[model samples]
Target: MSNRVINILVPVISILLGLLVGAIVMLFSGYDPVNGYIALWNGIFGDSYAIGETIRQISPYILAGLAVAFAFRTGLFNIGVEGQLMVGWFAAVYVGAAFELPMIIHLPITLLAAALAGALWGLVPGILKATLRVHEVIVTIMMNYVALHVVNALIKTVSNGSYKTEKIQPTASLRSDFLSNLTDYSTLHYGIFVALAMVIVMWFILEKTKTGFELKSVGFNENASQYAGMNVKKNIVLSMVISGAFAGLAGAMEGLGTFGSMTSLGGFTGIGFDGIAVALLGANTPLGVIFGASLFGSLKYGANNMPNAANIPLEIVSIVVALIIFFVASGYIIRVGLQRLKKKKEAK
Candidate 1:
């Protein structure tokens, strides 16, 4: 089989294996796997509200996946997306609640503020990596804590020691009355359009731009790119900034669309961490990220129905997701097995 075919086949096979394993686990636990699966399916697609909510949930995942995928493409592991997203959320809400500009200006400015905040947060680790050879993973992990504490402090300062901020003004909101009504009063918003636009932007930058070539070349080999007259350090920093911008946009989805406010968190949101899985499942491609995000979003949203509809525990869905991720991570083994099978067929 061709490499492209193999690439596609790996994930498909992994998904099937995951579901099969999940079924076995359900059987061992004395629950009906069929009912669990049916509940999962219905939760995602049973009603207009469910579909709308699923789409809303997916919008941020798409951006989060893009953030991680962008960094991976440029040979960077940005674990700071959670921190960046937190800061972005705070920045967006701050702007949205403070300003009273017209919709055309207020919304764009609020969104831009969020992206800028994320980019700035990402810049520190990028600079350290490029100039001092510090490992991004270590720096980013520490930064996550910094972002969390700092944002929480800022929230309390702004909200007079409250845990949440004020709701954003109407002009800065992404909510759409028409869409809400169409979806039976779901929280779906215009953030989906922004997420889709960024997908195209990522594709264009990676596939059609000169900067993209330099970034990829640098990622493949810094020494070789430098020898070929590319600015490796610059590309590295730029890649992180761009990745951070995508992460920030994800925060905007929550602040400007879903919640229209910011809240102090006792712990991590897990969305940024989930981006790692999404990027892995996507094969680190722009188009692939959407598919990964959709699968993840649907599974996460649908998982809620298992308990109510099938008497199955919610933890079962988590186990299934974990198994799926494990299979995806074991793609090398699958590929090797496929290659051996192909060789045997050719020998015959």
Candidate 2:
């Protein structure tokens, strides 16, 4: 199968398999799988409220997925995406709250601060890898904890030990009450457009630009790239910075669009690590990441709604997500299934 086809189909099969296995597990546990799934579906897609939630969920998943996909292309494992995201969230919240500028100026400024902060956070691991010969995976992992502690401390200091920052100015906020007219109650915003734009922009750069070729070359063979006079160190740092920027934007979306402001919202923000699964499932392409993110987002959004209506637990979503990750990581099974599917079709 072609990479494109596998990229498109693998996630679909993985999701179906996950749901099937989840149903089995539910049955064994004495729970009605159907009712649980029904409730979940209602939670995110049953009503206008659910649709809004679905779009809201997609915001973070999109950027975080892009973060991982970008780093993967450069042969870097940015475990520090969480850290970068945290710092970016902090910067956006802090700057957004501190300022009272016009909407046009405030919005861009807050977003830029987030991107810059994330880039700075990523630059650390990048430098460590380039100059100290440290493995980015290790550095990024440690940095996650470092960033958490640092942000926790900052939040405490700012709010006199409070757990969160105050709400941002209206100009900096992304929500539209007009959306409330469309849906009774929904937190979804137009920030999803920004995520989509980023996906397209990232895809263009990686597929059609010289810089992208340089980064991919380094990923394929650092030694060969260096021999070919490519700047390996530069590319490594650049990749990390770009990856971190994406993560930052993800957190920013949550703060500005979904949550209305940034609160001390990191300890439980598993979205960074979740991006790994999203990237792998999508085969690390920009377009693929968007679809992967949307799938995961929908399941999460949908599962929440199912519980209220069907007496099902929302935690099923987590199990389903885990299964999707596992299958995507081991993709040969998908290839085998495709081959069998083709053979059966040919026979028919």
Candidate 3:
């Protein structure tokens, strides 16, 4: 079989295996997997509201996945997406609430603030990695904590000790009454359009640009890229900045679209961590990230109905998702097994 076929088959096979394992677990636990899945499906697609919410849920996941995937392609592990997202969220909300400009100017400015904040957060690690050879993973992990506490403190300061910020100005909000009414008053917004635009942006940058080639070349071999006269350190820093910008847009989606305000969080939102799985599942491609994010968004939103509709634990869905991620992570094993089987068939 061609490698292209195998590449396609891997995710399909992994999903099937995950569902099969989930079924077995459900059987052993005395629950009906069929009903559980049906409930899950209904929860995601039973009505227009469900569909709208699922799309809304997917918007942020797409940007987050792109952030992680971009870093991965650049040979960097950015574990600080969560931190970057929080700072972005705070920045966007601050601009939205504090300003009173028209929508054309206000919305763009709010979004820009978010992206800038995220890029600045990412720049620290990028600079450290480029200049001092500090590991991005460690630096990013520490930055997540810094972002969390610092944003929390800022929120308190802005709101006078309140846990939430004031409502964003209407002009800056991504929410649309038309979309909400179309989807039975679901919290749907124009953020999906923003997410889709970034998908194209990522694709165009990686597949059709010289900077992207340099970035990928650096990722493949720093020494070789340096020998070729490419600025390795510059590429590294640029990659991180772009990746951070994507993460910041994700936070903007939540603040400007879903909630229209920033809230002090007691813990991480888990969106950034989930992006790792999303990137893995999508094979770190822009188009694949959409599919991965859709699946995750559906499962996550639909899991809420399992307990009520099928008496199945919500944890079952989590297990299934985890198993899918495990299989994706172990894709090499599946590829090897398939290749061996092909060889045996050829001999026969």
Candidate 4:
């Protein structure tokens, strides 16, 4: 098979394998897989509400996935996306709640605050990696903890020891009443448009821009890029900043679109971490990330219905998702197997 064909088949086969394994496990556990899947399907596409919720969930996933994919394309392991997202969430919420401006001004300022906060968070690791020759993964992981504490303390101080902040002002809200009314009162909002626009921006930057070429070149070969007069260090820092900006937009969706407030967290939001899986499964491409986020979002939206409709534990859905990720991670094996089949076919 051609490389493109193999690439397509790998994910497809992985998904099939994941579902098959999930079914076998359900059967062994004495739950009906057919009914479980039916419920899952219904939850994702049964009505307008389900579809709206899925899209709402997918919006953030797309942004987060883009964050990870952009960094991966630049050969950076940005483990700190979670931290950047948290700080961004706080920044967006703080600005949204603290300000009393017109919608035109308030919303843009709030979104900018979130993006800037995330860029600052990512800048630390980028600078460390470029100047001190420190490993990005280590710095980012450490930053996650620091970010959590910093946000928590800030929230506590502002809320007078409370863990949650006040709701954002109406002007700063991203929620769209029209969307909600159209979707049967689902929580879908204008944030989905923001996320989609960002995806297009990312794709354009990576595929058509000179700066993007330099960054990809640096990732491909730092020494060659340096010899070619490209600012490798600058590109490294820029990549992280842009990646964090995407992550921040994700936090903005949550703060301004979904929750409309900031909540102190003792742990990671899980969205950034899940973005790693999303980036991998999406093959680190923008369009791929959209589809990957859609699949993951569907599963997340549908998982709750499985227990009630199929008498299956919620853990089964988790297992299924995990299996899919595992299969995606092991895609190289599938590639090798496909190459062998192609060789045999040619031999015959």
Candidate 5:
């Protein structure tokens, strides 16, 4: 009857509904849902290697989720996380390869450059919204293209006109041994630690700091915040800067932890866009984003496994995700349904 109870019930019901939908779709497509899920489970959680890969999948997602969540909390729609991520990725990789230093020093330096690059990318949209009164959605959407081409050009220049960057010095790479044995010596690395640290930082900034309050206040009402003597413009720019920085960190994690080099992309990474879903699913909370990111990451990790192990199309994972997102997006409907039930119970 309580809001909290409804909150918990809705997600559980949503998941069951998603599964039911997936089963129906699978049956119609001449596939078996059980077999698909089994394969998906094994690929992500079957063994040590699979588990390592799951962590790998979750690493960048954590950062990307944070990007969207922070923006949402600020009451800003930051569609440019993808662009911010690209520039950050390119900056980190370029710097990573441009220098040679001790592992401890070089790694942090490169990562910082990535965060800064992302922050700059975010600032453009923030300034537009604050000074020019441009809608962030449009500015961010346009910025994605700018970042994509800029990164592409940078990649070409850095790689001597090639589509990739020279590999970073080994010192710049995140280290992991347990995962090395699994994934056939795959790329999972210490970037997970970085992501975890960032999550903690985000939590601290949002929950315990004055700046966070200012941002949230501005998000609630820019005019009110200004009337209350809060610097609304600064908060607006700062929110985007912080949001973009988180996205940049994600790009750095992927570049250094997974790819170990840069590649010229034809377009946005899509992870930034995925972050929007994550933000919504997590209710735009730090902890919620972590769980959302983990769920999505597990699905992605399992997608490849599903086909090989269960004779099912990998599309099932996407279907489940889509259903879950749909349910979350219709939260108002859920609330109304809950209210009707409460009224009937009171009548009884």
Candidate 6:
């Protein structure tokens, strides 16, 4: 079989295996897998509202997944997406609340602030990794806590004892009345258009641009790329900066589109963490990440209705999602199996 064929088969088979195992587990636990999945499907697709909500939830996941995937393609582990996202969220909201301008200027400025904040947050770890030879994973993980506390403190100071900032100016909001009316007042917003545009932008950059080639080549082999006269260190830092920009845009989606305000969090939002799983499941590609995010988003939206409809635990959905991720992570085993099967057919 061709490698492309194998690539497609692997993820498909992994998804099937995950669903099969999930069904078995549900059955063993005295729950009807049929009804459970039916409930899930209905929740995601039964009506326009469900569909809109699923898309709304998945929009940020797509951006977050892209953030992680972009870093992975450049041979970097950006565990700091969570922190970057938080800072971006705060920056966007702060700008939106503090400034008053026309929509044309106000919206772009707020979004750009988020992207810059996220990029700056990511650049620190990238610089450390390149100049100081520090492990990005550790630095990023530590930075997550630092960002959380710093943002929490800032919000508290400005919030007049509240845990969140005041509502953003109307011009800075991403809400669209047309989309809301179409979706039956669901939380779906104009951010989906931005998310989709980013997907296309990412695909173009990675597949059709020279900068993308340099980044991917460095990820594939840094020493070889350097020997070939590419600035490996520069590419590494640039890659992280680009990846963080995507993550910061994700925060903008939440701040400007979903909430229109910034809130103090007691803990992480987990969106960035989920991006790790998403990138893995999607094989670290822009197009694949959209599918992965859709699947995850559907499962998340569906899980809400599963308990009331099936009397099953919500954790079951999480377990199934985890199993899917595990199967995707172990894809090498599936690839080997496919290779053996191909060899047998060729021998005949």
lDDT by residue (tens digit), candidate 4, 1-348: 787898889878877887788888888988888898898889899899999999999998998999999999998988888888898899999999998999999999999999999999999899989898899999999998999999999999989999999899999999999999999999999999999999999999999999999989998999999999999889999999999998888899999999999988968889988888878778899998998898888888887788888788877778866776687667778889998999999899
lDDT of 1 by residue, 1-348 (tens): 777888779878888888889889889988999998899889999999999999999999999999999999989999999998999999999999998999999999999999999999899999999999999999999999999999999999999989999999999999999999999999999999999999999999998999998998898899999999999899999999999999999999999999999989999888888888888888899988998899888888988888999999878778976776678667778988988887888899
The best candidate by lDDT is 1
Q: Please report how far candidate 1 places residue 345 from its true position, in Å.
A: 2.8
lDDT string, candidate 5, 105-185, tens digits: 999999999999999999999998988889999999999999998888888887888888998878888756666775566
Off by over 4 Å in 2: 1-12, 313-317, 324-331, 340-348
Q: Which tens-of-lDDT digit does each residue in 20-45 have in candidate 6?
A: 89889889888998998888788899
* Structural similarity to truth (TM-score) of each candidate: 0.95, 0.91, 0.95, 0.94, 0.93, 0.94
Ranking by TM-score: 1, 3, 4, 6, 5, 2
lDDT of each: 0.91, 0.83, 0.91, 0.90, 0.85, 0.89
**Candidate 1 vs candidate 6, TM-score winner:** 1
| Residue ranges of candidate 6 with Cα displaced over 4 Å | 1-9
Query: How do the residues 1-348 of candidate 3 rate in per-residue lDDT, one tens digit apiece?
Result: 777888888777877887788888888888998998788788899899999998999999999999999999989998999999999999999999999999999999999999999999999999999999999999999999999999999999999999999999999999999999999999999999999999999999999999999999998899999999999999999999999999999999999999999989999999988888888778899998998888788778877888899988767767866775676667778888988888888899
The window of 10 residues in a row where model 4 has the poorest summed lDDT is 320-329
Clashes of 5: 0
Deviation from native of the Cα of residue 308 in model 1, angstroms: 1.6
lDDT leaderboard ranking:
1, 3, 4, 6, 5, 2
Could you report the Cα RMSD, in angstroms, for every candidate shown? 1.6, 2.6, 1.7, 1.8, 2.1, 1.8
After the best TM-score superposition of candidate 5, give how far the Cα of residue 125 lies from its true spot, in angstroms.
1.1
Tens digit per residue, CA lDDT, model 2, 1-348: 455776568667766777788888778767788887777677767889878888889888989989999999989988888888888888888888898999999999988898888899999999999888899999988988888888888888887879878888999987888775577778877788888988997988799999999999998899999999999999999999999999898889987888766566557488888888788767899988987788778876776655566655556556755665576566668778887877777789
What stretches of model 3 exceed 4 Å from their correct place?
1-8, 328-332
Where model 5 places Cα greater than 4 Å from the true spot, the runs are 1-8, 182-184, 314-317, 328-347
Residue pairs that clash (backbone atoms under 3 angstroms), model 4: none
